[model samples]
Target: MSLPPTFDPVRALSLARETLSIEATAVNAMADRMDDSFARAVALVLGSSGRVVVMGMGKSGHVGRKIAATLASTGTPAMFVHPAEASHGDLGMITAADVVLGISNSGESEELTAILPLIKRMGVPLVALTGRVQSTLGRHAAVVLDASVEKEACPHNLAPTASTTAQLAMGDALAVALLDARGFKADDFARSHPGGALGRKLLTHVSDVMRSGDGVPRVRLDADLMTLMREISAKGLGMSAIVDGEGAVLGVFTDGDLRRLIEKSGSSVDLRALTAREVMHPNPRTVRADALAVEAADLMESNRVTSLLVVDDAGSLTGALNSNDLMRAKVI
Candidate 1:
């Protein structure tokens, strides 16, 4: 490849802006063109007993893959099958229980149109995403979604730029409508994306990332200040929970309290005279073990504390966790 003799930055920037504007206009026009056909397409997918088998060719195939992925992650079962491959043996993947979503900007792609008759004969509902509803692919469809674009973003008006954008926007609209109809919530989305950040936040619980048993730093109420500090340092949680004889949390002594006590008392105060009960902050923030880890992070941020006491429903100290623990679990 050779560089252009003279690179015109002005022309390049102008074309880039024009391309974005055209695609934006195409997608906006699709939103305005949404009609009963779009709703019927959503209904067809919802009514299907199996998955949504999305088929497209060329650039439309790329958009179909993305649409299928979005639909599958958002509570709708969907998969993308290449049009040309479907003509070979991939059509066996489709069944009567599934719905076919065919994409063709011209509604005349030989690969896609070749399988339209076979798909129809299978008694499967065909939802067409095409520019020409009167073409072969659209005429044989049970529901036709108009994805027509005024023009392509390409300067020569040959590439599949604006038309592909319209198809993508229409696919997203269908997925969102079906998601709402199925009552798909954030938790449902998280379940599908277990390795994602949202999944970590919604699925991780306090107990899953908390320090339990001897791992928790705790000192008796009557324990000396030195014992409390030792426990805090030993556990590396920056704080020590003061518990009663029944192992119930009474208060918490944090490193902040220690600094304040030393600053107020100066060098004249006897450090050995202090007890856990005297220096501990009463009613420290607590979280239940069953609560979400993200909830613990929010509680820490709102209270401006780095550590929290994980307790049972009966108010007994069951575990302990700090901001570091949540971060380690990737729940922050």
Candidate 2:
């Protein structure tokens, strides 16, 4: 109401820096506070026959959802259930075989407290990520991981800024530890995220999208200019592969070569007499069918070429693809 104080860059920057420093300090403090409780929680999750059920209220619930996703993507089965909803039939989603991860900044969220007794009666392992060990949620939990921070980043110290940051960090630590314990690899991650661009880059093979089985523009080494142009036009790849009788790639011919040859010879050379091997670029850039599609893309960009010939270990032409194929495959 009082004109919002005068706008000052120095004061605004100081506040921003202070907030970051406070949150960073909270995360580091959580790291130092890691004890046997964190290890116990990890082991319980890893050994559980059922999924991890994560529950919280308010801002804690938001953090719990992200934690569940991280666990699911990193080789652990997990799901988030709202504490308030758990009391109204959502508890059916839980089972005796599951491990329950409860989050409460004060360790006294009433909605969580209502279901703690039931989880105990069912003999399910309870892992609590909380700020107060003496509070109700802490006492009921079998293992308690402290998520306390020195203070909130908010000037009034009333919001959940630093506290939520610590919770997220601890959640990430749990997921990463579980990932290593399970020997989760990049291929496993790619399988879980097949629709993403990174998944395409990692999972797509050179053979999956290449033009093969007569689609590749192949011609004999001694083919004439008409034969070379016909092969390129028929395949629609802007280039042709010159191969031997055994299908071994001897050289490659492209539109650029045609232009250069015509310019150098003053457009007077006999087209029918020009052979493929005489004008083709030998030892062209090639990739194996088993290699990752991203590697092929990297090669194309580095060499400034639009297409690559896919060959086998024996250097025989098997397939071919251009930039458009990579774009359609989402590897571009």
Can you list the residue pairs that collide in candidate 1?
Answer: none
Report, for all candidates in order, the number of backbone clashes: 0, 0
lDDT of 1 by residue, 1-332 (tens): 97697888899999999999999999988888788888888888989899999999999999999999999999999999998998889999999999999999999999999998899899999999999999999999999999999999999999999999999998898999999999999999999988999999999999899999999999998899999999999999999999999989999999999999999999898988899989988888999999999999999999899999999977899999999999999998
TM-score of model 2 (CA atoms): 0.91
How far residue 65's Cα lies from its native spot in candidate 2, in Å, is: 0.4
In TM-score terms, candidate 1 sits at 0.97
Q: List pairs with backbone clashes in candidate 2.
A: none
Candidate 2 C-alpha lDDT tens digits along 1-332: 54556878898999999999999999998898788988899999988999999999999999999999999999999999998999999998999999999999999899999999999988899999999987899999889999998899999999999999999999999999999999999989998999998799999999988999889999998889898999999999999999999999999999888888888898578867989988899999999999999999999999999999999999999999999999999998
| Model 1 alpha-carbon drift over 4 Å, by segment | 1-3
- Which candidate wins on TM-score? 1
Model 1 shows how many backbone clashes?
0
Q: Candidate 2: lDDT over CA atoms? A: 0.93
